[model samples]
Target: MNITLPGKAATLMASQRERAEKQRARLGVEARSWYRISNAASDDEAEVMIYDEVGGWFGCTADDMIAELRQITAPRMRVRINSPGGSVFEGIAIANALRAHPASVTVQVDAVAASIASVIAMAGDRIEMAPNSMLMIHDASGLCMGNAADMEEMAELLDLISDNIADAYAARAGGTREQWRERMRAETWYLPEDAVENGLADEAVQAPKAGNAPPAPEEDDEPDMARAWDLAAYGYQGPRRDEPKTEEQQPLTINIGAAVGEDFVEQLRALVRQEVKDRTVAPASDATPTGPVAETEPVEPAPEPAAVPEPEVPAAEPVDAWAADIAGLLTTPADDWAADLTHLIGPDTSSRAAAEA
Candidate 1:
């Protein structure tokens, strides 16, 4: 098959292939067995495990999976997957084979079913996810190593593959293909509950507990499984097993006008005015000047200026206009106001003169 891969995926494949080749150089044919099959002898059901990358130079190929699948005469099959997915064409081929099989196939997402592995998931007669498992879907992507024409062709091919994948999702989930396509473009990830809610899985089942299991498997005894895989290579960095799910918090809002009543505002203003008046009436400081103390005697206070005649009062304005004027006057800082009361009152010269004195 013609090989096309995402840049990082291709790099990973190359590294694994090199390691596999080296192992084969020393271990001979034993190193090439990349897939696992169990319970094939049972007539009722058989198990197939796809716990690694899909078709590649070193990993399990579609032909190998199909060849083994054909040998299983069981009427029911269980395909367990915990894969990061591999070649899109290979995944499609495997999905097709499972769909065409005479046995009823049930797919269990043991840990994760991401990328093209999710496509293979659609072939199941019934899909189930463990409570903490996840399934992800995204637009098909691959690297093109040729000229402009070749790049364009590759882009077109990717589009076609995405559409086909979308169809597969829609067929199982009962949504319009365009709706699924939009989600795929955004690279949607689904927890078990979300998968069931979206109709992608029949149900989320409890994880099976092994009888007589060891206290904990040794770290070096098994390869780094699901959680250890670098899913960031495919732009997925979401919740995983044994991690807490954080919920988004709503922003806090305060309504000052509602919290402070008009009566409180009036009381506050009165307090401020009394405070200002006390500060103004206090005697000036008796401390000597910082630069130099003048020896001259203090001059007598100048006689009070002759009282000016009050201006003629204008006719009363509209209530709104009067309110607006009062509001504008209130905006001035209390500290900026002069001690003169006449500027704020109607013809009350006696009170103003008394205040000035």
Candidate 2:
């Protein structure tokens, strides 16, 4: 077990350090990787493991990783997390396994323990972060899918996960669930010293030859670990989406044609019979739908009056006294008709001659 860092070890270390330096340059940050403290069992009987890089957002993989952890039969266990954090559920699972261990468990962060990784780090009996090392605790982020029922189940699952986190974080750190929720919502990040102060971390480890300078706790983004699982598990295939769909886009509909069948005439007959039976069994109205006033035929309009014709006027008769005066002037009044006639004809002429002489 006391093999010096030689033989093939120097070559391996150089290659790993080369890769780490390249990755750090490519990522525009210092290269960080998980390192298990060799001979850590004798020193503290507690070994620590590193969770680094993007995988930290997902926590460490459990794909055969569980078996890897089981190989460690150390009296005490230490999980040294140097990560940006990873999957929430996986970290929780790892933490759960650690929590059940009979040995004292400690989480040592040499660099950054963030997001779900921070949650995982909390599983230790004592949470320790180097002064230069930082610890961040934030909410989980992931995609989801399924039918309405499936979605509902997922929602319930998220609620349960959050509840467990609340209880665990609160027990380890001194704060209310409400405060945790606020901080998680804000995507809060904390320095090693502040993490300890906030009850999330128990102690701050001294910075070795490495940078263990504690940072000011700040805020960060939540990872979408759940969503990643949902995506992979359900085989999501569709257009891209920024947020997960709440319910299935389409619902199942009944086949009316199948239910109706080909016996349309029989169906109609049955309906008619049912209607008749209903009418007979139910009360029938005796009165007409139209009221008596409305039913009476409208009285014939009164005939218009005929226009009347005006009366004709007759001419007036000649006066009798004016006729008799003319007769007396014409002849002797006692004379007969002939004398009257002569008087009427001659007397006027003789009076005219005597006047002329």
Candidate 3:
């Protein structure tokens, strides 16, 4: 039953109270006391709504819930809860009363079942959480102003209260008592899926009927501690992350070489050939001879030369070895010319090889 709390727990609770008061002032009411009961056409069935702070108001204890139930003799009942929990003792009392009631109880959370509210929800034979709803669990919170001995006693009392709360949660949830205690210590929050996964809720409620306007969401003045923790963990809106703005994102660009497919190669080659042809044709036209005729002189053609007789000559002697070698060298293939020159250089083989190397 022993528990350890953070050093700032007292400050956190005070801030929570202060914020809740602000919300009450803004809403122009205690922002609570939303409850109702309906007897269906069948006398043996009923539905009850618990849609605000638990434990009622001043001078109204847990007895209010019991009083409402006593008037209904229905054999089957539905309890709908959407509450920010108040008065853990009263919540526990209501839960116990529901547990003892002869009717089979089915609980549906329309919005949220948090803290002791979640404990009361566990009283149901079957529990359902709305797709958009949540459940939260944590150790009991309180304030104590006194001497060291008094403070020690209060701490011990808190631990005992926490253990009782854990017992309430562990009885219905998936995990063992110790594991639930650890989860409570961490101040866990559960989306509908999370609740189902952890056995806290039996199912997710179906979508509301068409043309039925959804209940307007309550203004959530999130407790500062919880707000800070959620922001650190799941961010502003639970698991969903805000998409990056267009201005925040870098523009995407594709590389031409990478993007061009094999089918484009022939088309690209044809384009290059057309460009080469245009360049070649433009310079050839510019290179055509251009001149102007004189104003006084007439255009004239050049005269052809007269024919002449061919001279007779005797045959010449054979060519010299050097001349013949020079002619042979000129006609030799470029690769063989180097070897021919090396041979013509009069066999200084070592020197030629050294030079070539």
CA lDDT of every candidate: 0.75, 0.59, 0.71
Q: Using Cα atoms with residue i matched to residue i, what is each candidate's TM-score against the true structure?
A: 0.52, 0.43, 0.49
Which candidate has the top score in lDDT? 1
Q: Give the per-residue lDDT of model 3 (tens digit) for 1-357.
A: 112234555675455446655665676644554466787736887898888777544223466558878877899988999988876766888899889989989999989898888988999999999879999998887666667876887778787888888887778875677888899899999999989998899998777677978677666743557656566565455433476646546677554335654223223333333333554574435565569845787658788788787897555334556545544544434546444443433322356335633
State the lDDT of candidate 1 residue by residue for 202-285, as single tens digits: 989986686977677687777656746788756897667667655554356554335765443333344345445666686989
Off by more than 4 A, model 1:
1-29, 32-34, 40-43, 207-357
Sorted by lDDT (best first), the order is 1, 3, 2
Error of 1 at 332 (Å): 91
**How does residue 262 of candidate 2 score in lDDT?**
29
Q: Candidate 2 lDDT, tens digit per residue, 134-242?
A: 8665555544444677556656665556556667679788678777877877777788778878888878876565567676555555555687768666786866677
Query: Against the true structure, whose TM-score is highest?
Result: 1
Model 1 CA lDDT for position 237? 75
Query: For every candidate structure, what is the RMSD over all alpha carbons to the true structure, in angstroms?
Result: 28.8, 39.4, 28.7
Whichever of 1 and 2 has more TM-score, that candidate is 1
Model 1 clash pairs? none
